[model samples]
Structure formats: C-alpha cells, structure tokens
Target chain A: MSKIKVVHYINQFFAGIGGEEKADTPAELHKGEVIGPGMAFQKGFGEEAEIIATIVCGDSYFNENIDKAKAEILEWVKDLAPDLFVAGPAFNAGRYGVACGTIATAVQEELGIKSMTGMYVENPGADMYKNKVYILETRDSAAGMRQAVKSMTAFALKYGKGEKIGASVEDGYMNQGIRVNFFEKERGSARAVKMLIAKLNDKPFTTEYPMPVFDKVDPMPAVKDMAHAKIAIVTSGGIVAKGNPDHIESSSASKFGEYDIEGLCDLDESTHETAHGGFDPVYANYDSDRVIPVDVLCDLEKEGVIGKLHTKFYSTVGNGTAVASSKKYGAEIAKLLKADGVDAVILTST
Target chain B: MVKEIERAGFPVAHICTVTPISMTVGANRIIPAIAIPHPLGNPALDKDEEKALRRKIVMNALNALQTDIDGQKVFEG
Candidate 1:
C-alpha cells in the first residue's frame, strides 16, 4: 500500500542550473522535490514508488573535492533513509558520470543503502565503478533519457522491493561479471542448430555469451638503435628478491614489486627466486635469471647491445590475477619506467 | 602489461610461452618462450647451452623492439 521512498541525485546542468560556468556549485538537497529527469523516473515509478528527495551537486565541485562532497552527500542520504538512491543517466559526460558513480557507490557502500546509476558503456566511470555498483547502460547522450529512465526505474523497483535482480542483459544493466541461471524453451542442441543456421543464412542472431572487448593500443615506433637505447625488464613471472622481501603473492597477486638490480649481474637461488604458484619453481629458484634473463641482459649491457639496463625491474605474478588488476599495475609500471627514461621494455611471462 | 607499456609510447617486446595470449592482449611485438616454468631457459640443456638459449631469446626480443610492425607479429628465434 505504501510507495517505496527514493532519493535521486543529479548534476547542476540537469538541475536547471548554469552549465560549465556553474559546475563549481556545491551540494544541495531538495526535500520532497522531483527535478529534471527525476520527473520521468517519478512517472515510471507511478504507483510503486515516489521521489522523496533530490540531491544536486556541481560536477567539478564534486570531483575537485571528492571526499568533502561525498561525506556531505552521505550525511544527507543517511538522514533521508530512502529505500533506493539513484544518480544520473549521465550518458557521455565524463565528469558528471564520474560524480554520479562516486556518489552512488559511496551511498551504497558507506551507508548500507541500495543505489544505482546509468551511463554510456565508454564512460570512464562505467569502467571504474561498474563492478562496485549497479550501472544501467544508456546511450552516449541524454537523447536516450526516456529509455534509460524506464529501464532504471524498473530495476530500482525490483531492488527496492528486495526482489531478485536478473542477468545484466535481461535487466538492461552493464555486465558486472555476475552469472544468473535460467531455463529456456529450447535445449542446447536446438539453440546451437538455430544459431548455426542463422549464421549460415547471414541472419542477425545474438550470442548467448559475448566476448569482452579488448583495448587496442597503437604500436610505438621501433627503437632506432639497440646500441644506444636504454632498455628495461618487466615480468609477470613472479620473480622477486630472495626471501620475497615484498611478499608478492604466489598467485592472484595483489601487488607488484620493483627491485634494484643496479649492481647485480645475475639472479641465483641465493639472490632471487619466484613467487609464482602456477609453475614448477625448481628452474626459476635455481636461477631467477631463467625467468627474467637478467644475466643475459647484463651481458648485453656489457656487449653494448643496449646503452644501459634500468636499475630497477618491475615484477608481479600473473597467476590467477584479474585482468583489470594487471592492467592497473601495467599502467603504473609504465609510468615509472617512462619517468626513468627507459627507451624500451622486454616483458617476460610464465 | 605489454600493451600498457607500449601504449605509454615505448616499444615493448613480449616474450611469453603463450603466444596466443600475447596476441589477444594486443602486444605488437611477440617472441615465444621455451616453456611456462623457465620461459627463457631450457633446463634440459647444459649450463653453457642453457645460457646460450636464453641469450638467443633475449636477442630475439631485442630485435622485435627494433623492427617496425603494422599489427601483432610473432618474431621467431
């Protein structure tokens, strides 16, 4: 009989405030007010729910003072105690999407409340917070507001009522690596045959499981001179200083290690070993250079095959580590190597 | 990891036992290693021979870095 109470969040632009020039506006809470896109959501919720409050913050203000803004917003959401907290269908606006993601995630995590937001697939916030929060996929711009509101409102109602949320595809949310099982009218063999025939006939057919899109990076130009190029070594082979000083994990590595090899010519059992649990450690333990090739690299340095060997080598275990984590470490390590003026890198993996 | 370093404007040579994974990860220059345990070393060989094998592989990786490539390409030792 009672409608679910919802608290909505939006940026200054959507709140009918000035655009970029007004992005420095601080947070404002309008109790019992349905503003901008919240009207569409209110209509979608109709009899099932009501927008009890709306929270608005400037995109730049929230991002520039993230902690302060988040703390202020969290206090308001706590006071409101709405059944569901929803942020923007920000679409392609990078800063707004990030703010919505940050605030929504904070409300859910810090306040123990159910929260959701919507954004385009390529929104930086989508990649940063999708796994942590429920982000509905919207078009690249606000032109898709109607559809976004319908889908987000439906999902919000289910979640606010404690109903089971369905698969990402079925619910119109970004795939967050959660798998839900459901039976279909046809069995595996029948579905396979149908898909095959559709493919053969060049008919459109959706795949049950879609492969993840990989980021393609343009190749950097080749090193012009091996004789003068400063080179470095990096590995996902789990190599580390003896005794595993940093205690890098044997598998599912949570961190990477950067060890100084400025004076070392080789990596032997006594000097270094592997922390990788995925492979036999005998060879690597006997001679860590077997995995990192530090000895040969040192030899190359002497032979003038390279101008110099970077003093530090970065290492992390790839065994069972998440691709996202690996990518994170890779980006960080690359920054450090670049700062060191390393011209090229040889990345070894086991 | 290779892709990240390459993306940062540095030529990168990825030497790994799994060439397909390197290709999938979009590494431009790839050199297949000997095995998963000791990617650069062949334990079956004598000490001198093993060191030579590693040297050869490292040389191949260096060569991969020096050569221009259009897309992903595996450089054989």
Candidate 2:
C-alpha cells in the first residue's frame, strides 16, 4: 500500500566525503538526499522502496570505537522508520565489508529488520558475518556494481513485499550454513542416501553444498630450542572476564587485550568470559581456562622446563574472522614478540 | 605462508588439529591436536587428564623443534 522505506549505510569513500583521513568520522544521518551507491539503489528500486535516509561513517572511526559507532548509528536509524537496510557492494575491500557486515548484523538483530550487503568471497567479511546477515556474493571489482545493486535491491523488494525468500547462496547472500525449518517436498535422509549411493556408484552427484576451503597455510620451521624455549599461548576462544568487561567484540575483532595473571594460577567464572561467536558460548563460559588453558600454560611455565613465560598473552575472537586479517594480526603480534626477544611461541587455537 | 616465514629463517612448528590438512598443505613439522576448537586438551576430560594430554602434545611439539627432517613431518607418540 505504501512505499517501502529504506535506509542505506555506506563507508567514507562511497559517501563522497574523503579517504583514510576521514575514516574516523562519526555516524551522520541525512534525509531526502541520496549519496554514492544510494543513487544507484534509488534508481534500481524505483518507486517500490524509497531511500528515506543515508547513514555514513568512516571505517576507521567505527573500527576504533565500535561501541560508540554502533550506538550513534543506531540512534540515527531509530527515527528513519526504514523497513529494510542495505550496505555496500563492498567488493573485495576488507574494511568496508567488515563495516557493512557489522552494521547489517546489528541492524537485523537489534531492529528486527532485514539487512543486506554485497561483498566478494575474499573480503573476509563474508566469512565472518555471512551466517548472521544476507551478504550477496559479488565480484572483486566495482565492475559488478550495477548487477550487484540490482540483485540486492531485488532481494530487498522481496523482503519488503513480505514474500518468502529462498536460501542464502540461492538468494545471492553468502550461505551461513544455517538450517531453516521448512516443509520439503522430498524426504531429507532418503534424498541424502540416494545421493550417497549415486556418488558411490561413480555417478556424478553434487553435494547439497560444499564447504569453502580455508587457505592452506604451511607450517614454519621448528624452533631451534624447544626444550629451553619460552612459549606463549594465544586463543580466539574469547577467554576474558566474567562479563567480558574488556568489551571485546564477538566477531571480526580489531582489539586484543591481555589479562594479567602473574601471581594468580587459575581462572574462575567470576574472573573470565568468552567473546568468541564461532562456538557454543555455554561451555567456554563455565571454564574460561578451558578455552585458552592459561592455567596449564602457567603450570608449565612454573615447572622451569622452559624459560620464563611472557607476562602478557594475546587474545581476540577468531570466529568469523577473515584469514587475511588474521594473518596480518599474527604478523603484528609476531613482530611484537620478536621485539621483546621472545624465543619461541606455542600459539594455541580453539 | 609458514614456509615463507621459515625461509625468512625463524624455525616454527605447528600444533594443529587437522594433521591431514596440515600435512597435505605441507607443514614442516606437525603435532596433532584432539579437535579444531580445543587443540591441546579436551575440556570434557578431568584437569589432570587434560594436563597430561597437553603436556604430551607440547612435548611432541618441543621434539619437533629439535628433530631434523627432509620434508613435512608428523610427530607420533
């Protein structure tokens, strides 16, 4: 009956504002004016959905101050009364995809609105937030701008129309491996068995979905002095304080803070919490040390079998993190450890 | 990438859950872990058992650093 009101979210560059220098700009809401891809979306959606407002902020700004950024953005969007939200066709840009994914997931969760974004598979944002939000698979370059926008808008239209939407990959969003409850025409186990039999018979049968390949990384050469080396432990298992008072993000983490336990031996529920979004949070919450095993490492350090342990251990939520970003963070930490003259590292992953 | 790091002359060993994947991907030295999430010790086990498991794996990793091999090597207990 009425036009579907939409709010468009974009980063600094697409906002036609500035570059890295403007990356820290706080969130601002503008009404009646369409900027950047907002113009393209306005054109694509035609009159079906009106781009009621456009929210823009610098990527670095949001990253550096996520809580403040999310708060400000949420404040701006509260009154816009948009039925749907759309972020960028971020292409292969890492930060933009992250920003888009973060904002979209938050909007979907907090506002109870459908949100969508377009990003290439390599963008790392797709892997991290694809399960939480609708991320349309896009090409690495801006060449697919028109198509991506059109596709995203079409999906938005379906949402606006209250029509049942199909599965993610099929509907242009990256598959989150989420199982949806629906009445299927075919029986599930029977179908799978039939397919399995066909595959066993050497018949060409496609799996319902194939798992994405995480880039295989080779192992570095062994440490020269293992018996006498100071090995540090690291974990993405979100082992922090009981309430995560440090406020580490659940996913796509940009901050890693270390807790000091120099004199203390073990971690208790009141002392530590998990911020990792990848796994079931219940298990980790019960025993923070179980995830990172700081207690075990501490005992190992106390035994004098190895050199003095590094006082501070690195921590960040690794769930839904991009491989490239993870590698970069690893390098940064490695450099820090190297500068500290640390001999060897025993990085524990969960 | 790890090889590149190794080529840069830092000797590193991997304690990985996916030994097959690590071997296939060509790790210089691989020490096996129980699972993907908790690689060293399973939380399901008691504290002492978990410690023993972790100690064993860490020892294997330590051994990997000392032992010289021609290609990707997996430590066996």
Candidate 3:
C-alpha cells in the first residue's frame, strides 16, 4: 500500500554535467531530485515506487579516488536509506561501469540495501563484481537507454517489493550462478530428445544449457626481431619461490605472485616449487624449470636469442580458477609488463 | 590469461599441452608442450636430454611469438 523509496546513481555525463572534460567532478547528492535516466526510471516505476534522490559522480573522480568516492556515496545512500539503490545502465563505458558496480555493491553489502546496476557483459567491472552483486546485462552504449530503463525499473520494483527474483535468463540479468528450481511442462529427457531430433533435422533449437561465450581478441602483431626484444615469462602452473612465499593457493588461486629472477639462470628444487595441485608436482618440484622453463629461457638470453630477459616472472594457479579472476589478473600483469618495457611474453599453463 | 595479454597489445605465446583449450580461450599463438605436469620437461630423459627437450619447446614458443598471424594458430613444438 506504501510507495517504495529508491535512490539512483549516475556518472557526470548522464547527469548532464559534462563529458570527459568534466570527468573530474566530485560526488554530488541531489536529495528529492530526479535527473537524466532517473526520469525514465521514474516513469517506469509509476506510482508503485519513487526516486528519492540521485547521486552523481564523475567517472574519473570515482575511479581515481575509489575509496573516498565510495565512502562519500555510502554515507549518502545510508542517510537516505532507500529501499533500493540503482546505478547506471553504464553499458560499455569502462570506468562508469566500475563506479556503478562499486557504489551499488557497497550499498548492498555495507548498508544492507538491495542494489543493482547494468552494464555490458564484457565490461571489466561486470567480471569483477557480477558475483558480488546483481548486474543486469545492457547494450554496449547509452543508445539502449530506453530498453535498459524499462528492464531495470521492472526488476527494481520487483526486488524493492521483496518479490522473489527469477532466473537470470528469465529476468534479463547476468547469471550470478544461483540456481532456482521450477517445474516445466516437459521432462528433461523429453527436452533432450526434442533437441536431438531438431539437431538431426538441421532445425533450430534452443539449448537448455548454453556453453560459455569467450571474447575473441584479434592477434597483436608478432614481436619483430626476437634478437632485440625484451621477453618476460608468465605461468599458470603455480610455480613460486621456495616455501611459496606469497602462499599462492594450490588451486583456484585468488592472487598471482611476481618474483624477481634477476641474475638467476634457473629455478631449482631448493629455490622454487609449484603450488599447482591439478597435476603431479614431483616433476615440477624436482626442477621448477620443468613448468616455467626459466633455465632454457636464460640459456636463450645468454645466446643472444633475445636482447633481454625481464627480471620479473608472474605466477598463478589456474586449476579451478574463475575466468573472471584470470582475466583481471592477466590485464593487471600485462600493464606491469608494458610498464617494464617488455616486448613479448611466454605464458605456460598446465 | 593469454587472451588478456594479447588484448592489451602485447604478443603472447601460450605454451600448453592442451591446444584446444588454448584455442577456445582465444589464444592467438600456441605451442604444444611435452606434458601437462612437466610442460617443458621429460623427466624420463636424462637431465641433459630433458634440458634439450625443454630448449626445443622454448624455442618453439619464441618462434610463435615472432610469427605474425591474423587469427589463432598452433605451432609445432
């Protein structure tokens, strides 16, 4: 019988503040105000729910000072105590998606409020925060604002009203790996047979379970003149310094290790071992070089096959690790390698 | 991880025993290794022979990195 109170969050551009030029603007909370996409959401909510306030922050400002920005926004959301908090359907704007995810997740986790945002499935923030919070998949840009607002507002009202959320595909949200049981008109065997028949007949049939889609990246041009290139080694075989200094997990590694191998020609049993539990560790432990090939790489460097061997090698366990986590680590390690002026990388996995 | 590095504009040569997984994960350049546990080593061989085997794999990986390609490729090791 009572209207649900809602708070909306947006980036400076969406708030009509400005674009990249005004991306340094700090957080601003407009209490009792509806701005930009909030208007669309307001219309979608109709009389069932009301947008109580809109919190806007510059994407750059939020990402650059993430802690301060999150703290500031958290205080505002807690003060308003809205039944639901909705951030942007940020789509493909990388930093905006991250900001939305951070604030939305904080509102839900730190304030015990229902919060959600929407973004493209491939956005870095989507991978980082999808499991931590609800993220509705949106088109790659704001051009989908109308459809995004419609779906987001519907989900917002349903969740705000304490209604049970449906499966991701049914509700149009990214899959968070939560399974809900429901009865269907046909049994699984019947569905399987139907699919088989359709496949044999070369007919179109939707699969009950879809394989994960991987983003294909065009190959970067090959490194020219290996004789003058700086090469680095990275491994998912979980090789680490003796005693596993960083304590990299034996499986489903949560973090990667960066170790300096300067002035070293090889990784030996006493100096290094593997943390990978996926395969037998005896061979790799007997000679850490077995997994990382540091010895051979050093030999190549000595022979002038490469101009230099980067001093640092990154290591992480891939066994059972989430694709999201791997992608996050890979991106970070790539940044570090680029900063070090490394020209190429050799990545080994088991 | 291979795709991430390549996506960032760095040429990456992925060395793994499973070429299909490498291709599935969008690795542009790949070199098959000796085995899963000892990707570069053949423990059954004498230490010197094993080192030679590893050298061959490493050489293949290096070559893969320097060979330009428009799409995914698996090179000989």
Strongest candidate by lDDT: 1
Task: Tell me the tens digit of each residue's lDDT in model 2 across A1-350.
Answer: 78999999998888988865566577888887799988988998887889989999886566546678887887777777689988897887656777789898898898888788889886757777888888888877678888888888888899877898788756877777777887868898988998999988999876776877654344444555544676655555567767776788877677766666666667767777678764446546666655555676677678866666666666777654555666666666666667766666554444
Model 1 chain A: ten consecutive residues of lowest lDDT: A318-327
lDDT of 3: 0.87
- For each prediction in turn, the share of the native Cα contacts (below 8 Å between chains A and B) that it retains comes to 0.80, 0.23, 0.86
**Cα misplacement distance, residue B36 of candidate 2 (Å):** 30
Runs of candidate 1 exceeding 4 Å displacement? A216-350, B1-77
Q: What are the C-alpha RMSDs, in order, of all predicted structures? A: 18.0, 15.5, 17.4
Candidate 1 lDDT by residue in tens digits, A1-350: 68999999999999998765577689999999999999999999989999999999987677657789999999999999998999998986666878888899999998999999999886667887898899999987788998899889999999999998888877888889876677899998999899999999999998887898768998899999889998999999999999999999986689999999998998898999999875668889999988999899899999998999999999999765666788899999999998999999999987
Query: Model 3's A-chain: what TM-score?
Result: 0.63
**Measured against the native two-chain assembly using Cα atoms, what DockQ does each of the candidate structures obtain, in the order listed?**
0.30, 0.12, 0.32
Off by over 4 Å in 2: A181-205, A209-350, B1-77
By summed lDDT, which 10 consecutive residues of candidate 3 chain B come out lowest? B17-26
Which lDDT tens digits does candidate 2 get at residues B39-76? Answer: 66577899788778877887776677667667778787
Docking outcome class, model 2: incorrect
Q: What TM-score, over all chains together, does every model reach?
A: 0.53, 0.52, 0.55
For each candidate in the order shown, give its overall lDDT on alpha carbons.
Answer: 0.88, 0.71, 0.87
